[model samples]
Target: MKTVADIILHNGNIQTQDGFHPMARAVAVSGKRILSVGSDRDILGLASSHTQVIDLDNRLVLPGFIDTHFHFYEWALNYDSIDFSRVGSFKEMENAVSNKALALGEGNWVLGQGFNESDWPENKIPDRYDLDRIAPNNPVCIWRCDLHLSVANSLGLKLAKIGFETPDPEDGVIAKDTSGRPTGVLKELASNLIRNVLPKPSRAAVLENMQKAVGDAHKFGLTSIHDIRLMGGLDGADALKAWQQLHRENRLHIRCHVALPGEMTDQAIDLGLCTGFGDDLLKIGYLKFFSDGGMGARTGWMTKKYLDAEFGMPLTPVADIERAVLKADQVGLSVMVHAVGDRANKEIIAMFQRIESHDRTRCIIPHRIEHVQMILPEDLEKLSTLKNIAVSCQPNNLSLDISMIDSCAGPRGKYAYALKNILKTGVPLMLSSDAPVADPNPLAGIYSAVTRKRMNKTPEKGWYVEQALSVEEAVKGYTITPAVASGTGDCLGSISKGKIADIIVLDQDIFKIDPDGIADTKVDITLFDGRIVHER
Candidate 1:
């Protein structure tokens, strides 16, 4: 008996992202997998009377995007929080917080995120005093755009019990004034002091917000994400539980790969959890480790002193991370280390090389370097030599970091965000948003990668034009490469026969449009597991 397709989309420009059948005019979906992909007539022939047949009207259809390093749990929880992503000055930030504080009433915590001082005209980092002036009665905390730093108001600091006498945590710093007073600027794990005190939303509220966040992700054409864990491992268990609960309730619309924090390596090993341990919708990803902080905070460990600042500090010692990686690797779990600066990337790459050489029988699951934001040419070459490693870079962050890097690194900025160069090394390069830190829209990321400019398309010639990728390369970074990174190359990344039918139709042909317009492109329809989950 001939298998009938549940849905047939014909007369479309389909980018399969599959080597064998890279382009197709139509695709037929059977249940939750692709039944056939061919010419219009061939695919339409697979449709039966019960099949839902639709004409694509020549729209561009492609594999659903996969964000390899999204902080989904954090993004979801901040769904209701104040957004400072668009604020242009300190005055605007203050007004925004003041408004929120007024609405939430006195003593109520006011939490917000996505503030980049680099974007402000003053270019001044917000401190506790600034927040205090705006919302003195409220315990307020706002995160820098990178999540590596946060500023809390005086009330918030008091509530967190942080004072001038509070010693810096092992991997964190609480900035102080020259007068020996706390400045309210928390870096790395120090933000946990404020986070630990902030009220957590109920589990039910988290699930509800997560459901909304899923819809928002679909709108941006994201069908899958690697839900990255933060440094302290505070949200690791809760994040996994939320995903599991969503899966159990059949509400998990997006494919998720949940990462375990490196801090939980012992616990994960004891529980016998390995990477790729779950079903398709949700799977255990890598054991996430941090080598250094973010560039925005000027805390990204660098080989040399920044032109304007001191050499940044390491968040986790290199030797400590290597030990944890070895333990996890022996048990079949891969590792993803966050390395943002040249020194950090060089050290982490060497660690991976050492592990590879010392253990010939290590797990096949590829370890990854998150935010290879800056890499010396030598480090990039070394990274390429590791057969069992991948690098996840964020172009959206590239859009955000260009000016910051230029100001801090000077000539060394040339090696930052070297996307094209990294690809030349024969290593899989995955593009992701690192959401809540940067915009999550895959289109925005693609725009940044191809244009090497902010959304407004600045500098006219583009920054580090040599690193700019072609439209095809950027698209592949979000599609096929991510599949390869996640060890799901065979089934999830492309539109091929017998592959999972996670696909999206775009309103415009990104490949044909002007590069600047790519960020404005929208997803017209999203098909997840062969079901029409979103239409706009």
Candidate 2:
């Protein structure tokens, strides 16, 4: 006889993205899998005398949220670092760094994330002298909100040996003053100059951070996340190794779809790691490539010059990115390129057009152009063609990029977050908070998609109200679309029978709430594999 396992959730409005059951009252779980879902009485009848039954008390239950893109490692390491998440003035930032340095003592590295020059009134990137004046002996590194840029103090530059003679790396830039001296700021590849010199964290530290990040994800009601960047350099692949350790220990609570950086695309291909190389806990989803830099960093490849500036270059040239995409497709590995500008998206689409198969597995499996921010009107159609190409959009960008749009895009800023336009073209859409840059709050992200308003709540309606999505469409992007993007749509997207028992019970009916209030809603309970992981 088959031994029955424990637990079942009954009496709730289960919104299974599966459509068949728009609302289910109960669900049965055996061990880690969902055994059945139906009426309250039907599911409760499956419970053995030993089964644990949970009454949801009419709270709305749905598939656990899945973040299609995020940097889990970075988020974890930042917990101990200085937080500039809310610091407004440069004085405030300096004070924060000084305080952190005092706490850590002299000579300690004072690091922080979420410092956006655009957010400052002066719209200027701070330099080494600013920190050198505060913490003269400490090495301080403050990452720009986009993570594509970092401003280090004089001490940090000295610690990393970054001097005037330091030639710019092929793909990165070290900002220089008008006098051609190092300006204590680095962009993109240039960031590695300091990171490479810094001592790598211990394996124990990596594990600890990984656990903390995972726990945080669970509390946010995320049962799955696609670790966006997993590239390792001279450190001997610590990121991959740490993830494997977490998987082996069964400590990785949520499903993880990891990406191998473009630098290691060859290695991933040689190892025969396709889209689904591992079990539920870990899998090789795609090979990530950078076609252009990020938006806030002003490095995103643009066809025409930026409205305010004449200088901007693609991280990878048009020819090179296309060639890499074609080669990755030929090798049976899916490709995902970060293309934020209209030109970058067009160039990536042109490259994807070369892929010649309808087979999702062999040809071009769900190739993604991450952050299709300023997509061209004409090129939107290309998304529907090309066998496996989806737009992995970051809708929360509207909240963060509002100031940038006014300063950078000037008149063309209207197209910043075009969710409605993108979706209407019949392209599959997935939503994510590029965290540490934006809050990983799915509700906030969803609210942004539907409303397109920033923190100040301007625009009355939205930047491009015609492109705004419906509440249901936006929610589907967070739940169903992400699962589909990760190749787990059948098992994880919805609250359905025989699916993974990962679900979230929200405090209010998401659909019934005011559109603007959606972001304010709370997660009452989060469950993973039928086990309660977080409860308010």
Candidate 3:
């Protein structure tokens, strides 16, 4: 009996991202997986008259992108929020919020995200007073691009119970004015004061947004993501429930490895759930915990003081985090801790060293550090030496942090986003968008990794030029590296026989194009689980 392919893509340049078969001209898909991949002639032989054949026209074809770290659920639910991702000035941010408030009418909460005052001409973060001046009637709260800082209007502050007399939460700060009144600018945990009070999006709203988000992601050629539960993670159990329900209904097209919070280790263990449990469409991932805050908020746990500021702070100190790691490891759940500063990474590495000392590869899955962004030159090798530890770095964050790294980190910024050195050690370097914090598009991330430059390609020579990675290396970070991290290496990540049929065809061959053009790259067509989901 001859096996027939359900669909076939031929006449194109295909980068397999697989070491075994580095390139191919055609690929055939049957059901939910790749049936064959070879030259056009070879693949065409496997296709029957019923096969849906797509001609690539000498374009670029690659495995769909996989974002290793993402706040996908939250990003989706907040889809209608005013996006400040590219707003250039504080005044512009205010105008955007005012417009949203007017559009939504008065009395309703006007939620928005992605405002970076650091990139503005004035270089000053917006304050509550500014938001009040623009949207006095509607309560407004907008997040900084980093998501670690937020500014709220007077009405928003009142709703969240934040006032002049309110003290900052532990491991967080409330910016105050000269007269010692609360400025309505909250950092880290302080921002949660507002988030906790805001009305949660209904279950229907979340599911709808999830579908819309995946549809939009397909346009960017994204096939998979690790949906990180943070900023009120697990949403008191609603988040995971929604994901599982979607999977059950066969409504989810994007592969997801939904991560839980570290504190939920007890609940996970109680349910006898281990990391990597569940079907391919949805799986349980590592337990996520914040070892420190973002550098943009000046709360990253750095050893030395930031320029003109005090030393950074860690949200969960070493001792506390170690306890959580040990508990999770004992229950067979892998850990993923966010560590951006040198001190934070060092502390996490030390904890893992101790955990592995008790048993080699203690957890079923390898432990990982998210955003191992800023590190000392001497400490660079420590992360790679841990065989079971992976580093998930967001190169796109580098584009946003290039100027901030230099201005705030001073001379210590030399080793920021050390991609070249990290790859040299042969440790798994997973690339991601950390979406809503940055563009979820993996091409933007790949461009930043390959060029080490901002969106406009400023600085001509690129920032930290020595830390740049090649185009292939960057693709692996977004593809195979994340696939392997999710325990899908055997089935996903590459356009090879037996792999899941998640593929994307590009309008242009990114390999032959200029480094800057990588960001402008667009997906011409996308196929997921052998089904055509997008074509542009």
> lDDT per model, in order?
0.92, 0.78, 0.86
Error of 2 at 66 (Å): 0.9
Leading candidate by lDDT: 1
lDDT of 2 by residue, 4-121 (tens): 5377888898887888877789877887788887898888888788998888998888889988878766677677887776777787887898899999999889888887667678
Candidate 1: deviation at residue 382, Å?
1.2
Per-residue C-alpha lDDT of model 3 across residues 1-536, encoded as one tens digit per residue? 13799998999899999998999999988998898889999999988779999888889999989998898988998988988888888788878888998999999999988877777888998788788899999998988888888888899999998887888888789889988878888989898899888887777888999999999999999989898877446363777898988988889899888889877778888898778888878888888888888888888888888995777788877788788788778767888999988888888888887877777444757888899888776667766667777889999998888878888987678778999998887778999999989999999999999999999898799987999999999999988887886678888898888888999999877788999999999999988887889999
Question: What are the per-residue Cα lDDT tens digits for candidate 1 across 1-536?
Answer: 13799999999999999998899999999999999999998888888889999899999999999999999999999998999888878889989999999999998999999998886789899888888889988999999999999999899999999997999998899999898789999999999998898888999999999999999999999999999999999999999999999999999999999999999999999999989898889999999999999888889999999988799989888999988988888889899999998999999999988988985646667899999888998888898898888889999998878778988998889999999999999889999999999999999999999999987788778998999999999999999999977889888899999989999999999999999999999999999998999999
Model 2: pairs clashing at backbone N, Cα or C within 3 Å:
none
Model 1 segments beyond 4 Å from truth? none
Error of 3 at 459 (Å): 1.6
Number of the candidate with higher TM-score, 2 or 3: 3
TM-score of each: 0.99, 0.95, 0.97
* Top candidate (TM-score): 1
Estimate candidate 3's alpha-carbon lDDT, on a 0 to 1 scale. Answer: 0.86
